[model samples]
Target: MILWFTVVQVVVAVVAGVLGIVLGLAGRRPSDLSVGGLALLELLLIAQIVIAIIAPLAGNPPTGSLLEYWVYLVSAALIPPAAVVWALLERSRWSTVIMGVGALAVAVMVWRMQVIWTVQVA
Candidate 1:
């Protein structure tokens, strides 16, 4: 888990969570973003993916811990798309809950990634 990537993911998750809460409270879903949000997030995710790939190739500390890093990377990569689908399916107060779940998921995945990077494999 690169620090910058982690930070970006955390921030995005927070915003997504806040958006989810608002959507839930407002009784509506935000399938994707209004416009710019989705684009920016997509870009960020892409950057993160690139970095994730590089971390292993560049001989980052995560080298010995490929499994964990890969899993979390895949997890982090999935949240946004999942959020979009979930929000669309529940275009009501439940949308917020969807966002909340996705956002929190990102956070958890990030933590997992960090742990994987640091822990030695048996």
Candidate 2:
């Protein structure tokens, strides 16, 4: 995991999460802002996926369990779409909150991925 990229992902995830939460608490239902924010996060995760693939070939392989890192990466990549689907189907403020929670969950997962890639031992 690239440190800078991880930082950017974390920042984006936090922003998306907070934005959705605030909008939901303000009684807003699913909107472009919330959905778009999640979409953006998803895009970033896709990029992270590519990076993860290339980084290892570039001789920057993770220090920890490669399988564990890959699992976390893959799981983190799935959260946004799931949350967006939930929000779209429900079309309620609470659904937006669920999106926020999902984004936050992705943030935590991404952080864990980083730790797995660089901090933990196999």
Candidate 3:
């Protein structure tokens, strides 16, 4: 796992979360800016998925359970799209909050993935 890429992911997730909160508090629905941010996050997650797959083949497999790591990666990848769909259907300030929660969840999931990747198997 590339450390810098993980850092970038974390930053993006945090920014998305903050934007979501702001939008929600301001009583605004999902705007183009927020949607674009989520889209960027989705792209980053896809890139992470690709890197996670290739890194193992390149001789840098995770030290923890491979299944668990893949689960985290897949879940992280799915969050933004699901959130967008949910927000569209709900169409309210709560939708923004939902997106915020999803963004924060992605950040936590990414951190967990790093932990799983670096853990030493006894």
lDDT of 3 by residue, 20-106 (tens): 988988898988877778899999999998999899999988889989888889989999999999999988998998898899899
| Candidate 2 clashes between residue pairs 3 or more apart in a chain or in different chains | none
Candidates sorted on TM-score, descending: 2, 3, 1
Candidate with best TM-score = 2
Give lDDT tens digits, candidate 2, residues 14-34. Answer: 999999999999999999999
Greater TM-score among 1 and 3 belongs to: 3
Off by over 4 Å in 2: none
Clashing pairs in 3: none
Q: How do the predictions measure up, each by TM-score?
A: 0.75, 0.97, 0.95
Worst 10-residue lDDT window, candidate 3: 113-122
Clashes of each: 0, 0, 0
